[model samples]
Target: MSILYVDHEINNLNSFKATFRRDAEIYLAESTEEGLKILGENKIDVIFADHQMPDMTGLEFLTLASNQYPSSIRVLLTGNAYTDEFKRAAGKGYFHSYVNKPWDEQQLRKLMISNLR
Candidate 1:
């Protein structure tokens, strides 16, 4: 399976790729636009976006992605506590799930693996 992870932080992107690269084909992007570009060229099984980004929020990025790649499992990564917006987004099926930033590598790998199956 292949995964696309979008984050503004270079360290976060590097860490994610380092953690999950062994489990799946990992693609990293620093912006929503770049993520979209990667999406256009790849067949991604999962999409994970950081909630707060310089260009667009994760929700906005996932919204656009869902419109184009409805089958890809969408996940949001945020450092903040779960808020009403997240609740609403979850209810509306904007994303498949979320992960808190500073994610536990093993748990996140499991989540990614489980969704692919």
Candidate 2:
């Protein structure tokens, strides 16, 4: 499975690679435009984006991804707490799940495995 992860932090990209290097083909993008460029060239199975990116909000990215890459599973990872309003807002897009930052590694692994299956 191919996964695309977008984040402004280089450490996060490196950490993701270190954590899931063997599980999937991972591609890292620092900006949404770059992510889309990679998407145009590869068959991405899933996409995870940081909500607070400098280029665009994760919600906006997912909204665009909904139209451009509808089949890719979209996941938003943020440090903010969940609110019904936020969930309702994201409902219009293709986001499959939301995870808070300081993410639980085990839970993330399980979520990815189940979704990829």
The CA lDDT of each predicted structure is 0.91, 0.86
**Which stretches of model 1 miss by more than 4 angstroms?**
none
* Residue-level lDDT tens digits of model 2 in 11-94: 988999889989889999989889889999999989998888887887788878878998888888889887675588577766
> What is the Å distance of residue 20 in model 2 from its true position?
0.3
Q: Return the TM-score for each candidate structure.
A: 0.95, 0.92
Clashing pairs in 1: none
The true-versus-predicted C-alpha distance at residue 71 of model 2, in Å, is 0.9
Q: Pick by TM-score: which candidate is best?
A: 1
Residue 86 of model 1: what lDDT?
Answer: 83
